[model samples]
Target: MRVLGVDPGLTRCGVGVVEGVAGRPLTMVGVGVVRTPADAELGHRLVEIERGIERWLDEYRPERLAVERVFSQHNVRTVMGTAQASAVAMLCAARRGIPVALHTPSEVKAAVTGSGRADKAQVGAMVTRLLRLDAPPKPADAADALALAICHIWRAPAQNRLQQAVAAHRTLKGRTA
Candidate 1:
């Protein structure tokens, strides 16, 4: 499966693409950050984010989009920007009919580093090793985006099975009723 992972932020939204299935080697198709001027108007920044995400979707044509879910933070302003950027990413993927998955920060960290409380350095180190890169992706955010993709790739199989099981159970229950 090909996945485009998005680490959304107001100024620097990270983007990375990874391709592979579970229990096998994965390839990093691409990695980069979408930058919008901090001074830009809120609407303008969102537009810039939309354009950047759209370009990535057009180029990568990923089967799934994995985005970092926005969580409540003490800094309301920062959280607001992140939520806005995240919405833009989801919008772009929805426009292309690409499936979107939202993973929490702790969930991503645990998947990549075996610890939900892992620090940035630990996550980056694990991402570097997982993708077989000589060096960690820069700016932390970039590495985070890659980590999100890796997490999704590894977890998707089990998630699919669980969904299928639930569907089957619902069908069986309906028949009995």
Candidate 2:
């Protein structure tokens, strides 16, 4: 399955696209960042995010979208903007009738690097090694985005199994008297 992963930040939103089924080294469809002026108004930032995500949807045409969940820390303002970007990304995916999954930054790190508390450099290094790249994906945010996609790929099977079981149960119920 093709997956688009997003790391939402108001100033710089990271996006990565990977395509493949479970347990596979997916092809790198794309990787980049959408930058908006930190001085821009919140409305402007949201617009930028909406447009960026829309473009990604058009370009990647991914089957599923994965995003990093908002983590509230000391920077209340940053958190709010990140949340706004996240909302915009999710909305874009929903409008296209695509499935969206939220993975925490820690979860993404753990899934990719074997440690939830791993640092950005560590995550970047692991991503480089896992994807067999000569260099780590530039800009920590982009690497984080790639890690998010990888996490979703690893997690997709249990979700698919659960979905299949639910569908089977629904079909059985419908056929019953």
Q: Rate the local accuracy (lDDT) of all candidates.
A: 0.95, 0.90
Q: Candidate 1: worst 10 consecutive residues by lDDT?
A: 154-163
Per-residue accuracy of model 1 over 14-52 as CA lDDT, tens digit each? 999999999999999999999999988999999999999
lDDT of 2: 0.90
- lDDT tens string, model 2, 90-149? 999999999999999889989988999999999999888877778989898998888899
Score candidate 2 by TM-score against the native: 0.90
- Once all C-alphas are superposed, what RMSD does model 1 give against the true structure? 1.3
Q: Which candidate achieves the best lDDT against the true structure?
A: 1
Give candidate 1 misplaced runs (Cα > 4 Å).
173-177
Clashing pairs in 1: none
